[model samples]
Target: MLGPVRIAITFAMSLMTTLASAQEVGSQKTFPARDSLAALDDPSPDAADCLRGFAWQNAAFDVQLESDDATLRSVRFPSPLDTGNPINDRVTMKWYVAKDKDGNVLHRPAVLVAHESGSGMTVGRLVAKTLSLYGVHAFLIHLPHYGDRRDRSIKPENQDVVTTMRQAVVDVRRGRDAIAVLPDVDTSYIGLQGTSLGGFVAALAGSLDGGFDKVYITLAGGDFHSLLVNGTNEAAKMRQKLADAGYSGDKLKQLVQQVEPLRIAHRLTPEQTWMFTGSEDKVVPFANAMALAKAAKISAEHHVIVPANHYSAILYFPTIIDLIVRESLPADVIPAALKSDS
Candidate 1:
């Protein structure tokens, strides 16, 4: 027979383990669906001040769709960043097809969604489903060794943080072209979106050549090295992961610096790039967001501030998705005032 105090302690420990598993499983599985978005309002002109200016060539790759652990169809494509292993070189993306009121699929503007660091792709899937339901097609891309990209055949599919970041940028940039060529996709315009960890990668990717017509970044900010060193929650976990992998102190600083967005952010088309950040995000402090905004030279209206924290930003998705559609869709799709003026 156990005393009441011992029973209480045991219960508390069990609860803590359950919570930790829940937090970690996001990368392992997609959660069940959430409430649908309200009927979309007429496409309205938004505060975006930039225009797509370049015509860069999209990369070429072989692609195929196959069944996966998720609810939607899973697609695999050759990533531009290769590690010599055929299974390891391919990237994974979840296809969330858009449909009209009658349930018929629609060809529309597409957004390649980069997920947060959870590896569960919770935020990515949420945003993708919402966008698809709201009319646009969204692809939830898994960064290297994430989701279906993992293969048991390859003993350790994981790359170092720096290598992973570089590969993520390569995969994302190549994904724009890959998504464009898919059937039922309207190639007239394509958008790039990233949240948190994904946002940092997207920032540098869009900077490389401006291949994407529209860029949307959420819950991420600049000075990545400092963020990793001092940031709480996700950042802290990342630091621990790196330390466990033999990256500590100045070595960790050196690794994160290679992927810092500030170095290449100036290349982003400020007018066409929009940043959505949470005001109370402790993981990515407000000052860091401002640092990125400054580096990218993003216009005032393009930098949107949400009245929530990093974890709580999900609560504001209805409002955020509306803005994303207005910001990323083609001219005929939304006819924004900025597009009209240009």
Candidate 2:
């Protein structure tokens, strides 16, 4: 029923809308490739200063612990990034304990779990529960601006990305110290495991010191600039925000280089490191995962490739958890529950 002129105008408006949508989705065309970020792997003068600023002279701290169940305890500590910001200056943990055949508590190997970005606290708890079933005590630490640590003044999305990462590194390292001092944990067999965002933070934290006997990183990779610029989902959102703030090209690279895990990845021994990545991951990109693996000197066998994409990588959690248990715990110490019936 519309006239020719009205029909033409309507079509033009639709065409413009389609073009705008395409532009938003294709904005990453100008971003750098994974190989171009090699400079991020090299050590810089600022690396030592960053490490020192986050280091704690002592592992001992005031811990308020409460029992949630026979096998789990809730713990709280003063945040390593404490700046008198009550909301951001405290850390919470869910500690899963190992037990003997008689239900008595036992001193056992421990792993510090770093959670993913969103809904990570729930995932962290699942990982802790699974690790406990394998006889390894697990400590899941909530990262800055996550779970109980969330603050209105510095929401995770609003804070400087590099600063949040640095704070995470400090927090994860301190978590290792906290677990090591626990009465029923074996200090000599401490390990680290992180999923996605947590995995990236764990990579940097593990590199800072040889505190952990093993490091298991899942669904995570390196080259911060490349991932932010070309990645999908949450990564895409981050890119748009940075671009709006006038951070692109070399300037954006410089900002992310401050917390690039590749810079200190060399400190991680290949023998003690393992990585799990999805082959179809667009959020993290396959090349980004390989970069982290190569920097850590991990062997091809140690690098696990899942058939699914980023979100679907959860399908392999059982297999991934089993692998981590086998690598992290002593042969004689693995619990019967984790043993294969075959």
Candidate 3:
């Protein structure tokens, strides 16, 4: 079943006019992306223990295209964070295929994107669209209870917070192997990008076993436990949700710890991981961002900071996309600008 667009984003890589919409050619070809989790092999007990919390088996899982089009393909896979519910057990990813001027799908780099906590995945979709414009196949994954996977019948108070978070991290990691088998992807380079809520999940997922070639975390940080206890806006809301569900004190700490970033962020290669943050951001805060940078061992060059707040960070969207394409992707894919964009 085709999932409707969760949010209609009306912006560009740099806050310019919106680009053309994806050509949704109803279901075309349904194929599978073979699991490439074997490459992430690590025998260390430390790595195993850390990833076991979220990655579950830390083994390969099925990734297949349930539906597709000329540009966008709907991917479905079994979530490693399975909770026995058929609806929430499956993972759905929006694959934005990149093509050349002749419209031939390019076998270029691919990036998996995780969205913020808002019901509408605004920034996540925009980032995926922007990255696709630059020749990288981008996949926007819907976390549990976000889009089609959401069980509208269940009330918010009844949802399981810890399990949802655990499943999210595992799903993101599985995305790396999922993209690895797509024909439109180069396979050699698969990365991840997450903003805010997604960023926190990506942080843990990217560290699971170095499955991704590159990882970018924007507007998120470590000590998610603290973020819940003291964060404002989305954090406060999520905290309240947990509180409503009778999760606090030791229970709350345990919930966040299951998917915390700092615990295993050190596993990611410093050169391949990047962190972007806002200087005056109060939602996630500068201190939180810095703490993640320190734990992840992100170099100064990799930890980019802009003088903006959480919401205003949208103003620098163009700059962020440009830098990601330049640094994370191969050099040859870089162009002065897309001919279509110009």
Which numbered prediction scores highest in lDDT against the true structure? Answer: 3
Candidate 2 lDDT over 105-126, as tens digits, reads 8778888899888744656666
Candidate 1 Cα misplacement greater than 4 A, ranges: 1-60, 66-71, 152-158, 330-342
TM-score of each: 0.76, 0.81, 0.86
lDDT of 2 at 312: 83
On the 0 to 100 scale, the lDDT of residue 257 in model 2 is: 83
The candidate scoring highest on TM-score is 3
Better model by TM-score: candidate 2 vs candidate 3: 3
Q: Candidate 2, which segments miss by more than 4 Å at Cα?
A: 1-60, 100-102, 152-154, 340-342
Write candidate 3's Cα lDDT for 255-307 as tens digits. 77766777777787999998889998888978889988998899998988999
Among residues 3 or more apart in sequence or in different chains, the pairs in candidate 3 whose N, CA or C atoms overlap within 3 Å are none
RMSD to truth, every model: 13.3, 16.1, 5.6
Off by over 4 Å in 3: 1-25, 28-49, 58-62, 66-68, 338-342
| CA lDDT, candidate 2, residue 214 | 88
In candidate 2, the residue pairs with backbone N, CA or C atoms under 3 Å apart (3 or more residues apart, or in different chains) clash, namely: none
Candidate 1 yields a Cα-based lDDT of 0.70
lDDT of 3: 0.75
lDDT of 1 by residue, 147-199 (tens): 77766665432466766777788788777766765777888778888999888
